[model samples]
Target: MLLADVVATSAALAATRSRKSKIAALAELLTRAGPGELPAVVAFLTGQPTQGRIGAGWRTLAELGAAPAGAPELTVAQVDAALGEVASASGSGSAQRRTVALRGLFARATQDEQRFLFRLLTGELRQGALEGVMVDAIATAAAVPGEVVRRAFMLSGRLPVTASAAVTGGERALGEFRLALGRPIRPMLASPAESLEEAIAEHASAIVEYKMDGARIQVHREGDEVHVYTRTLREITGSVGELVELVRALPCRSVVLDGETLALSDDGRPRPFQETMSRFGSTRDEQVRALLLRPYFFDCLHLDGEDLLDAPLRERNNALRTVAGAHLIPGESEPGAPAEILESALEAGHEGVMVKSLDSPYAAGRRGRAWLKVKPVHTLDLVVLAAEWGHGRRTGYLSNLHLGARDPDGGPPIMVGKTFKGLTDELLAWQTKTFPELETRRDDWTVYLRPELVVEIELDGAQVSTRYPGGVALRFARVVRYRPDKQAHDADTIDAVRATLKG
Candidate 1:
């Protein structure tokens, strides 16, 4: 298919608020796509390159000065190939090579295609549809159960690859996607609870365990081969050798363990999250020695030749304890012990505790309420929609931020609230320097941004509002930190903000 066809479809998809329409548009495109073009097509429609993170930042994209072609002639494969060069370009003259490649690619695209390409390369499609909507579209195009496609996508950690298999071989193809040893699947996520008691009430029989403030890790081991992946499925086995060695000594020949890893202080208390990340994100040997990370296994998704993902929490916990032994995170609260567990977790300097239904199965990639995380203070990952120049001592800086929560439907993020609080001088300077690069358009009062950056914000709660498009606004929202580790796609949805109001 021509790249313009997909771009046109994306424009149509973005124009609608109905998810059904978005899915239909995508499904129609998939039905027409050649087998080889499926991956590129899916990637383009989702606003991500098949090559992934081709180092084309806003600065790099802005440098690709090309006039749009009056007519479209570029093919999807041609664009994919060009992006591949951008991804592969490195070392001497790489920047120049990438510039040439981007210019050439954009020069052949029509005006709409150029606009679409700019959004796609910058990782903000704003097409009102992404992986969630695409899942159903893939299922419709392939004539398979949505759960089957969802399972395959979760296991492979890539929807494009999953869609390819589904399109080519249907159910039989999706069946091939299993929890393979040494392959990491996306980690199961938790919903926020209003309080520990509320979580306990919802679950009835619950396993309350410490919710550690650490990076999530999924370990897969097959004999001598061991691999560890982060929440986003980036392999980190090389940097954290100590973790690999720990799993290597386990009795099982092969296993898939889901857990949290953090660097503990000398007193055995968990260190600050930044301290853990300093070692987690670094490759320096000295940093490793300074802050050794320890793994606290929570759930076992696979053991030997068996897949425990279908098993309930009770069964999975047993298997996890059997395999992980002392490495398992202790669940001090069972059934009626939610309050006690919360206290213990707090006393230990941990963030909070997680309440899980005993019989719930591991729903990987699904952020359902089967697992409820309760923290003393509420926090949400919100998208920065705009910024305002500061006055007084903060003048000459973009100090105040306009925050938006993700729209659950296939739509742009809806404004929830705004805040100027909790920014350091360094943060103000960074925002002043960076916001203009991400600018879509601006007014005299607010410099609007493309919703691409995720900011972790702490809030008192949320209240029904007439001022925001979301119909609610965050109360006393303050920036906790700028989460460079996350993207706008990972921000908390409006539903979550409303949940707080409901509570």
Candidate 2:
């Protein structure tokens, strides 16, 4: 298949606001892909090259000012091979080599194709279609149920391979994917809950565990050999020798444990999240050893010789405790009242509690309500100072609200943060039409609007920030809803936002 065809489909997906239309366009592309081209097509549509991260970022792409080819002649195979060269280029003169290859690659692409390639390479595809939408497309093209595709994707952890199998074979081929000893699958995620009482009300007798603010890890062990992976399934076996050693010493001959890794102070309190991340992302042994990350085993997906992915949480916790005695996270199943447990978590300076259904199995890659994370929420009525032009399905609309907190000391509103999450297409259309009418000025990327639009934002808390002029920023901020009845004067004060950062 020609790269131009793939680029055209991406453009179509971006232009349409309908999810069904996006799925149809993707499915059509899947149908047209030959066996050899299926994997490359899947990767490109998902806004990535088959060779991930190719050592190039936005900075590297900025310098490659290659003119586009007058005509389309690039094939998927040819483009993928060129990216492979860029991905494999290393050491000595990789930057120069990458530039040489990227110039040739982009020079052959047309203007639209060049835009698509930039988005794909810079990890800013902005297409509403990610792996979730691609999964549906694969199912539609393969004539398989979405559940079957999701299950296979959960186990395999590689959508490209799963898509190839779905295209060539059928449900039977997808069924072949299962939990293996050394393979790392995506870890399960939890949705945020209003409060502990609310979480307990939904999951009455649930497993309430301490929700630590740290890196999520999945450890796969076989006898003495151990491999640790991050939440994104990136292998970190060599960097974290202490973590590997801890998992290796488990009582079980083989195991697959899911938990969090963090650097804890001598008082047993968790260290700052950035301190843990420092070691987690480090490649130097001394840097890693400076702040040792201890793993707290929570769920055992595999124990001894058998897989427990299909087992209930009750059984998995038992397996986890049996394998890791002191390393198990502090939690209980129907052991006490939810309020008391939450108080203990807060007193220990931890993030809140995660209430999970005792009977639910390990539902990897899905953030279902079976597991609810109860954390204190901080809501603020903030004014939208400005907004940026949207991309992909949000094409001609205004997205990414630039939120600002009111300064009651007779000053302009302080810009706190920016967020594009939780905005529906309807909201996007309304903002696009309204913001221009209220525009104070116009720039290339953002529309400088008068702070007349008030938005109610939901956030976890605030943290000291270096980026925003406010000296503090909201953490995990998302637009809950727009406050049509409220005005800019009703917005929360900057002091209120900064107060959440303490205690």
Q: What is the lDDT of candidate 1?
A: 0.86
CA shift at 326, candidate 2, in angstroms? Answer: 1.1
Top model number, lDDT: 1
Q: After superposition, how far is residue 47 of candidate 2 from its true place, in Å?
A: 1.0
lDDT of predicted model 2: 0.82
Candidate 2, which segments miss by more than 4 Å at Cα?
283-288, 378-503
What are the candidates' C-alpha RMSDs? 2.5, 11.7
Per-residue error at 222 for model 2, in Å? 0.5
> How do the predictions measure up, each by TM-score?
0.93, 0.77
Go through the candidates in order and give the clash count of each. 0, 0
lDDT of each: 0.86, 0.82
